[model samples]
Target: MPIIIQPAEASHVLPITELVNLFAAENLMLPRTEESVRQTLADWLVAVDPDAQPDDPPILACGALVPLTETLVELRSLAVHPSQQGKGLGGHMVNHLVQMARERGYHQICALTLREQFFVRLGFEPVDRWSISPKVWQACIYCPKFHRCDEVAVIMNLVENPQAAVHPLARPAGWNTLLKWSEWQPLRLAYKQKQAQVQ
Candidate 1:
């Protein structure tokens, strides 16, 4: 099926929620409520047959680019309809969002994903989950599985100068103030808690 990648519109909310929650039901990804979807609908991208009529596109796949901090964004809630699986639609949506992030001046994009290899194949490198800023945990704190979260963090640099765009959570010279450390400390705790549970 021919599909186009485009920014999601207001009318796309219900289908996007349904698609995301389909995977959520199977423990594949985080579930999204209509309110949550509505709140961030502007950041979402939809894969649909462009020939379809106005206001009711059949959203074959969907995802969102959620800004986590000034220089970092998280790709969350990526989903593709089961019938459209393995057709490279999910990858297309991801690349589209990555470009959007680049254009918007984000230095890095990351995702907490169970499908680490899939993102890896798309040029993302796996990183320590704790190595990400705790801002990534805002939505996570609301999650029922927060105490036992099990998602791998993967990141890709959007800048042409990768070295210049250091991962936001990396500690650097003179940056050891309490405020900075406190801001990033939570993910380390979350990571260790998950690690201890495994052992």
Candidate 2:
């Protein structure tokens, strides 16, 4: 069966939410409201199986790229159907989104993910989450487990020139930002515990 990769339509919104919420239920991601999906519908890209019968779901996978700054975008809400995992559809969707970001004049794209190796294989390198925009953290602050986050931050540079690939973070997050520092402490402790367990 052939799958089509394209901009999400109004029809795709519900399926995309359904697919993403399935993972969100497993604590793999933050649950999205239908209204949130509707609001950011334009930012979303969906992979659909157009030839499906009446019983089939219209979407197989979906992801969104949200701009944090003119040169940077945060890749979020990426989800693949459970039946569709390990089929390379996730990578294909990411590549398509990267191209779309480049076309739109973005210099870098970033994601906070537990699937670190997957994004690494797709040309993203590890970066400090604080290196991303506070707008990114603004969304995280709403997450229920913000105090014990398990996600890793990864980024990909889109410049054709190697030297231009380095993206300078807008403002470094530090002690001066009292609220962010307070929020990060628990996650820091959780990471330390994980590290201790591995030792």
Candidate 3:
């Protein structure tokens, strides 16, 4: 199938939500509602058959870049229809999102995913989940799996050599490490408090 990648349209809201929630049903990803998809439609891209009708394109795959901080963005709601899974549609969509991130001036793109190797194969390196503390505070804190998240954090540095710009969580020394460590401490304390409350 010839695939065309483009920004999502208003018509894509339902299909995008359905596609993402399909994986969420399996606990593989977060569920999205039509309203949520509509709100972030501009940040999302959908893969479709170029020959399809404009009013109801079949979304083969979809993903979005969600701004998390000044220099960071999270890759979210990446889903590929079952029929297109092994045909590289997901990878293609991800590459498109990465390019969009670079063009938008984001220093880094990260994702918390169960498919660590999938992102790793695309140049993302595994990092400690706590490394992206903003994500933890903004979303993970409210997740039911906060205390036992099974996902791995993976990052791709868009502006510099990833090796030289290693995330602080993966490095043990330096001021950056100190800052990240300081940031992580309070979160750890908060987690302990939340755990105590739950018990």
Candidate 4:
């Protein structure tokens, strides 16, 4: 089926949440509520089948580009409805987001995804997760999977001579496989404080 991908609007909030939560139910992605979808609707894109009948769901897939810093953005909430998998909708959505990021003047785009190969095929290279420290500090620290996130971080530089463009947040020299103590200390302390308050 042919799909028209465009920025999500007010009408897309409900179906977008439904599509994302469908994958979240299977542990394939994080869940999103209608309110969260609405609040960030400007950052989201949806693919719709223009010819679908009235009874059919209007959204086929969706994703969002969440800004992490002045130069970096993260691809989040990418999902293709089960019925639409294998039709390249996911890649199409990603390409659209990448183009959006570039047009918005972002230096790089990143994603923490289980499907690393898929992103790699689209020119994103695997990067150490900690190198994107702002992302970890902003969202990952609060995630239940913080201690055991299985997703790989991938980045694509959207500039001339992409191969030579260093990652905006390149891992410091001598950085080990694990995160440095100082690097994660604040997040660890904050998590503890959050837990204490919850208790």
Candidate 5:
């Protein structure tokens, strides 16, 4: 059967959600809400089975590119249905997204994943998670394993001489004191209380 890779449609939502959540259940990836998928719909790509039977689903796989900065993006919510694994669907979807990233002028793409070898096979190099950007930490702070994150960071440069375009700012030694979400929880609660009183 022919596989079609294209920008995801509203009809692809449930299949994509199910594939992602399958991995999320094993803690291999983060779970996504339907609303989050809807909002990032434009960034998503789906691979469809062109010859599916009338009752069979059309989508076989899905993934998305999440922008981290002007020159950087992260590959998120990547998954292939269990029945479809080992058939190169994941690689095909990944290559499609990489092509899309380059076409959009993004210099680098990264993934925080447990499957480092899988990404390496696709030309990604391992990097320190901190080396990416603080924006990644925004999501990390919400993760249950923030202090003990186990996911390795894999990076791939789609542009020639990628190092030449590295952002000029020096990478911080560690997360800044102010950026720790835990440090601001009290302030956040207090602000909410004040807003409630005003209302």
Candidate 6:
């Protein structure tokens, strides 16, 4: 059977959500809301089952590329249904997203993921999580495990020329020092202490 890759339609929302949430349940990825998926539908791509009957399922796999900055985009919600795994569907979706990023003139694409090998297999290199833009951490601050984030940052440069240099998030101008996870240990301890005092 042929798998067609195309822009996700409105009907794909539920299947995409269900596929992604399966990984979310295992903490492999973050859970996504249907509303959020709808808002960024344009960024999503889906693989469809070509030979299904009328009442059969429509989408087979899905993924999206979310712009994080003018030159950077984050690949989000990459999910392949259980039945569709190991068939190159995930790689196909990644290739589609990378192509889209290149088309939009993005310099780099990054993913904060536990699946480091998977991203590396797709040409992404491991990078320090602290090297990513601060905007990437905005959502992390609200997460329960903010201080103990386990995801690693992986990045792929889309452009041929080295125009924009990647900046380290912790060393923003006027900041005292470049604080990475290890260096932030004291800060996390202080935060916990402060929270204890408030309680």
Query: Which of the predicted structures, 3 or 4, would earn the higher TM-score when compared with the native?
Result: 4
- lDDT (tens digit, per residue) of candidate 1 on 17-86: 9999989888787789899889988899999886766654478899999886677789999999887899
Go through the candidates in order and give the C-alpha RMSD of each one to the true structure.
7.2, 9.2, 5.4, 4.9, 6.4, 6.9
Using TM-score as the yardstick, the better of models 1 and 2 is 2
lDDT, candidate 4, 90-151, per-residue tens: 99999999999999987778889999999999988887776564444555665667678899
Worst 10 residues of 4 by lDDT: 174-183
Residues 169-197, candidate 5, lDDT per residue (tens digit)?
34356321111112234334445555575
Tens-digit per-residue lDDT, 70-161, candidate 2: 67788999999877889999999999999989888887788999999999999988777765655566567657778788899888878753
Of 2 and 6, the candidate ahead on TM-score is 2
Report the lDDT tens digits of candidate 6 across residue range 45-164: 999877877876667888998876688788888888887889888998999989988998888888888789998899987776765555566555655566788998888878764344
TM of each candidate vs. truth: 0.79, 0.80, 0.80, 0.82, 0.79, 0.78
Instruction: Tally clashes: model 4.
Output: 0
lDDT: which is higher, 1 or 5?
1
Models ranked on TM-score: 4, 2, 3, 1, 5, 6
Name the top TM-score candidate. 4
lDDT for 174 in candidate 2 is: 27
lDDT of 3 by residue, 128-160 (tens): 666574434454666667668899878887876
For model 6, the stretches where C-alpha displacement exceeds 4 angstroms are 54-56, 142-145, 165-199
Tell me the spans in candidate 4 whose CA falls farther than 4 Å from its real position: 161-186, 189-199
Give the lDDT of residue 14 in candidate 3: 93
**In candidate 6, residue 96 scores what lDDT?**
93
Q: Which stretches of candidate 1 lie over 4 Å from their true place?
A: 51-57, 162-183, 187-199
